[model samples]
Target: VRLAMGARDLENNTVEVARRDTLTKETLSLDNIENTVADLLDDIQKNIFRKALNYRQEHTITVDTYEEFKEKLEEGGFILAHWDGTPETEERIKAETKATIRCIPLAGDTTPGVCMVTGKPSVQRVLFARAY
Candidate 1:
């Protein structure tokens, strides 16, 4: 059976450790391994997905003005804001705020507007976040 690899568990897993907790003689039963893997998969599909989706929803923000964008950017999380779609404006925003446009959603707000930084016309909003 295939195991589901959840985001939370994968994010928490660390390969480097101070010491080995398990002894050489220690072993796991096939049933235990299968059950653990199965449980993890279920958690990934149900719990992790929901948690991540919620996190994104909670963190996402929309701004029509540069002032609003700057204020929200300081607090962290993703910002869905209109960009003038110019390299100069994008670079200036990133240089000032340490945030970069992460992606343009396939189904984002299609409403035309002005860029937050340059006040130039923008076709759509783009996702922006601080570099990790």
Candidate 2:
């Protein structure tokens, strides 16, 4: 704080309180960074779970399967559909059909289903939304 205050010429401001934040520079490789990112993604998954719970509480509807979900796509919100994690379907869906995916799930047995667009078998449940 003292060094930053001096550098910023904040000595003239008496009412401006300052505090210092210290951080350590650990020796880390790209692998370490990748692991850290993975850890962060784990936390984000938890956060998303909470959000999903809230979403369910707020707007719960029943669609038994991917086929059923696809049949009801004319009306829109966030639609969860199985995908191959490709931009082609998502992008094409957005371009031709005007749907945007909000997100993909973190982990699940989300059963393989056909892509909402190409009718190809999907690997994961990719979210879908209608964009403005």
lDDT of 2 by residue, 1-132 (tens): 221223233344322222222222222233345565466556656777888889754542334354566555665556666665677766766676666766666765578776655667777676666666
- Model 2, residue 121: C-alpha shift (Å): 2.3
lDDT of 2 at 20: 24
Tens-place lDDT per residue, model 1, 1-132, is: 233344553565422211122212222234456565566556556765787889999999998888999999889999999998888888999899989999988895799888888888889999999987
Q: Which candidate is the best by TM-score?
A: 1
Pairs with steric clashes in candidate 2 = none
lDDT of the candidates, in the order given:
0.75, 0.55
Query: Candidate 1: global Cα-lDDT?
Result: 0.75
Q: What TM-score would every model get versus the actual structure?
A: 0.68, 0.45
**RMSD vs true structure, all candidates:** 9.9, 11.1
Model 1 pairs whose backbones collide: none
